[model samples]
Target: MTIHSVPGDFHIPFDDLKVVARGLVRPECVLALDDGSLVTAHGQGGYSIISSVGEVSHHLAHCDTARKYVPNGIALAPNGKMLFADLGNQYGGIFSLDRHGHLETVLDSVDGTSLPPSNFVMVDEHDVLWFTVSTRNVPRSKSWNHHVRDGFIGVIDGDGARIVADGLGYTNEIAFSPDRRWVYVNETYAQRISRYPLTGSAAKPRLGKRETLVQLSEADLPDGLAFDVAGGLWVTCIASNKVLLVRPDRTVQVIVEDSDPAHVGRIAAGIRESSLEHADMQTPGNSRLGNVSSIAFGGRDMRTAYLGCLLDDCVRSFRSPIPGVALPHRSRRIR
Candidate 1:
């Protein structure tokens, strides 16, 4: 499968970007729909719905009074429910939120082991659910080192939920290839993007051997994964505030970036020395993008790029030269 590269001269100008939605807290994951609306992961609890006209409304969960709702990655189910990964302080799990704000537990424990701070979740076209756990470390921040490899990917379908792949180096996000033949994921601590071929029966699915697609540098701790219609993979880096494009040919391009060299250097050093502290990732040097963490394509043409961030209160938007691969939820309504 030969994939060509995007135009070398194409890049997103920071000055031309616009704010799509505001007053969001830790909007770490954004899912754009065909009608120009967006659903992003809310830091405080549950998720927020941004209407096409820029109206914002929150549907927070009141499931647990003791545990704070720290949603990381989110997905829009075909039935209009929102599936969010609970990154709670002491525990982690995947939960679903209905239109009425009713919450239901999807998976809190798998294979007799309780999930540890779930990171990302996705519902594919077939209604099959997939998720990732960045690491098994108690604090999770302890696995910020490149050497930690307890991360894994799990799937839920007709056969029930089970881990299909393990030994990942801090998996952050996962995306299926355009044809749904391959599953791609970003290993944040390992600084690489890897993919596995889809094999076996649909009911009893399996993933083939992992293939390294992109080995990134410490400065680019990949956090998000999205595929453009042209076969390019767009990755968002947390500390450096960079959006990179990995072409089908495996060549890399910096589509946009805003960073403080000194701050990025400190983060890189901590990762290299396996001493990264949670405090180190608390604040980003640049406030413009709030350490952009995720990217999504929306709008009528699917050429509008929406950025999710760790520290920002809004999702940023920009025009892209290439249209993005339409996600399974693009045509689904929030109801």
Candidate 2:
């Protein structure tokens, strides 16, 4: 793995009219709705709906997805149903939603115990819900320290659910490989992306055993990865203040850098919400609003890259050379 300084002249891309939501307080999770509007979960505020151009017009049924912590991850159920993962502040849980944002508890406890921070979520064609529990047990604000242990990947089968993978450290994000045989997760504190083969094995997948698709060091924090239709990864790096295009050959190059982290701080200083290994890496440029927390491909063709910046309270869309994975219909509504 080689790192390039990318001459000082480099610049990360920004939008001409970044979407700021009047109704959203601090958006922690965002998903594209079926009508092309966006469904966002906040740190304290609650869930909201926004326009393609970034207008916050309506609240989704006054739904509250978070507890001590606001919701962290959200996805459309396979049936176009609304499903969001919550950090329950002390424990984690998964909730369901309606277009208007009505809420219903789906699977709150796992393996007879309550959850610790439901960090991420994804649903497949069969309605088998794939989600993450940030930790099996951990304290608030200390989640980063256990990234490699608290992590567990499970499927809520048609009849509710059961734990499938266990003992993941501060697991933060989950996405399926294009072939659907593997689940890729990010260890925010460990600074690596682990790929677990979903062959239905009984044993817990160990970090030592799973392939590390990407690794960041003390300086770089890797977060919010998305797959292009080409099956490659578009990964955000906090330390370098850039997004990377990673190929299967284990080589990476900057897709965009020039991100404004002046407000967030340089890699050495750290971003406010950044995890342990890359704590000082998320600083956003004064003009950037905040660090890019989430990215989605939504447009009629799924070619536009939508960036969700938690700090700024808005979403930005960009034209990418590579196409992105088409999210399932329940969560993706392209107006």
Cα lDDT tens digits for candidate 2, 36-145: 67777666524667876666754443544334545667776655556678766466688776665566777888778777668777776665677877666555445454
| Candidate lDDT values, in order | 0.89, 0.61
- Provide the lowest-lDDT 10-residue window in model 2: 200-209
Candidate 2 deviant stretches above 4 angstroms = 1-23, 33-35, 60-69, 78-80, 99-101, 146-148, 158-160, 200-209, 238-241, 258-289, 330-335
Candidate 2 similarity to native, TM-score: 0.78
Each model's total of backbone clashes: 0, 32
Candidate 1 per-residue lDDT over residues 1-335, each given as its tens digit: 56454678788877778988898988999999888789999888789989999999888887656678799999988888899998887789999988777888899999999999999998888778999999989898899888999999998998888999999999889998887789899999899999999997765678999999999885788999899987889999999888999988888899988877888899999999998888998988754668899999889988899999999899888888888999989999875
Point out where model 1 deviates above 4 Å.
1-5
Return model 2's CA RMSD, one decimal.
5.5
The 10-residue segment of model 1 with minimum total lDDT is: 1-10
